[model samples]
Target: MHAAVGLALISLLILLLLPFAHHAVLFGAEGLGIGTLRDTYLIAVDAPFGNLAISGHMLAGAVVTLLAPLQLIPWLRMRHPGWHRWSGRVITLLGLVTGAAGLVHILSRGTIGGWVMDLGFGLYGLLLMLACVQTLRTARAGRMRDHRAWALRTFWLAIGSWLYRVHYGLWYLATDGLASNPDFSGTFDLMQNFAFYLPYLLIVELWLRLQRRGV
Candidate 1:
């Protein structure tokens, strides 16, 4: 039953992530000048540092989002420990890069929604970096229990960008753009700045606590 559920989740995750990853790849390419920068909102000619930072963040985030689900496969980890370790290393590094680059972009260019968005996104980046660092540190110390918890946190954070889009897509479908503006300063948009990741992280925390209690 657990295996079946895991497979279902992994499948669903991959399905949701496909288009998001594709979009990230294209956006990253355009930001780096491999293609035309049609969206000056993200990639501007005048802000080279911000462009580079956000571009790198998108590219690294794409890989992290796609690779993260595979890392959760118990059989693969059991049978191919080397692959697990190497992939975990890659995920950790890319996660750090993703988080740092995002922070850099926020500091350099700032988000369209102003200080509220900046504060929320800045906190998200910091938490992502923290999760990545703790995952690596706990693993290095041979603390599998703590390592697993942190890894789960890292996984959720790694896919946060895609989740952000998914939330908006679902919201728009349900509400017909209710309380949502182009500048993203509306009530719903303001809530969404932190909603995509924080609630998921809260759920992870609850799950971790339940596991510790053997409930």
Candidate 2:
């Protein structure tokens, strides 16, 4: 059941991000600031460094999302260990780069929730970097079990970007669209800041504990 849910979420994220990846490849950062999201991308475009960070975040995010699901499939690891290791290394490096770039975006541009949102996402990026480092360290140490646990934690946090959008889409539908809906903007902003990432960390902690107990 958990595996099925994970696959569904991964597929959903891939579907959502694939277009952005193509747009980025074909048109680059200039292509992103359009439609309802034009303002956000415009803000990033205003500053040279902001453009770099956001572009790096977008591309690296797409790369990690593409590689992440494959890492979780047991058969791939068993049958093609070499590919798994190489891909894992690439994912780890890209994940760290993207996390740092995300934090840069949050701190430099700010967000709808202000400091609260910045702090929430800032910490999420911090946690992701820590998990990525620990996963790599454990892998180098030949501690496969610990490495796998950290890798899963890293994967969960890495997908927070996609999960946030999913949760926001559901909320948008519940409120019959966010168009001219200023009342719920604050609430939704706050929720999106923490909803997907924090709970996921807690759940992974519990899963690790249960696994240790042979559950």
Candidate 3:
């Protein structure tokens, strides 16, 4: 029953992520001159480094979004421990790549919403990289309990890009785009810049606390 539930959730997550991943891959390719679907705003013709950084972030983020959830399936970890270990390594590596590239882009080109968005996203990237490092460090030290806690944090951050879009989509559908603008400097936009990952991370921290308390 647990396996079934896990599979169902993972499947749903993949389904929701399919389009986002596809777009990321395509956009990344285009930014790198592998394709012609370029958006000048995202991939400036004059800024190769910034383009590369953002493109790499998107591509790695797409893969992380797809793979992170599989790492959580209890049956997969119990039955195929080797798979878990190797996949964890890939996820951590890509998570760092995603975070680093994002930071690079933000620092180089900045976000459309100006310094506020840059600050919010910059912090998000820093936290993501930190989680990835902590996850790997704990695992390497054979600290399984600490490893699991960091791994859960890593998973949430791995899919945060997707969650950011999901939050905007729901908000637009409910309010017809209140407190949002193309520049992404509106009140809701400002809140959303940090909301997608911070709240989730906070919840994970709470859950970890409960586990520690035997609650």
Candidate 4:
């Protein structure tokens, strides 16, 4: 619950910053901070494809920011299974489409951190899609508990858009973060990235374990 609240609070902060798009994290020449929040990238996301990609990205953020959090409430979940499933479908679809668009934006940046950034968000997209499928599989298998578990996993990945911003902010405040280089702050080293998925997966593991223990 603490983590979930963290996710929500962080998401809210991101939401506060979202209206400004990519400008929010401006730092060193290295892209000192995180996030591909640029309106320029989002505007033309997939140029030949019209604005579909950009529109989807914005819309996806809206759904996650505005609606997905409410579903986290226990009573809300129980009271609105139908709404939950419908919203879950929206999240799954939005995560894929926007994530893909985000990947394109990330790749076009052509910086070292740009590459890492692209991969991070691209992997996130694939993981989100996989989580959605796993969620459906668990549901089909009639494993309600597993469904619940995977739901949390999928939700976290979806909420990752929010987590990334908050993580970067705390990292900034803690490290006397770069003021001139995005690349410096959002740097790329394989070992450092161990902190990324390990903590993420560990959170999932701990959450599932606690659910099992009925904690």
Instruction: TM-score each candidate.
Output: 0.96, 0.81, 0.96, 0.66
Mark the regions of model 3 whose C-alpha exceeds 4 Å error after superposition.
none
Once fitted onto the true fold, the runs of candidate 4 whose alpha carbons sit more than 4 angstroms away are: 1-51, 104-112, 178-180, 184-198, 210-215
Cα RMSD (angstroms) for every candidate in the order listed: 1.2, 3.9, 1.2, 7.0
The residue-by-residue lDDT of candidate 3 on 1-215, one tens digit each, is: 58798789888988998999998998898888896865468888887888889989988988888888888889889999999899988888998899999999988888988998998899999998899889889999999999999999998988888999999999999999999999998999999889989999999999999999999
Q: Model 2, stretches more than 4 Å misplaced? A: 1-28, 31-46, 177-185
Candidate 1 whole-model C-alpha lDDT, 0 to 1: 0.90
Please say which candidate is ahead in lDDT: 2 or 3: 3
Model 1 misplaced stretches (Cα beyond 4 Å)? none
lDDT of each: 0.90, 0.75, 0.90, 0.57
Consecutive 10-residue window with the lowest summed lDDT within model 4? 24-33
Write down the RMSD of candidate 2 (Cα, Å): 3.9
What are the per-residue Cα lDDT tens digits for candidate 2 across 12-69?
A: 7667766645654433344344333343432444566776777777778777766776
lDDT of 4: 0.57
Q: Which ranking of candidates, highest TM-score first?
A: 3, 1, 2, 4
- lDDT for position 8 in model 3: 95
Candidate numbers, best lDDT first, in rank order: 3, 1, 2, 4
Native-referenced Cα lDDT, model 2: 0.75
**Alpha-carbon deviation at 40 in model 4, angstroms:** 3.8
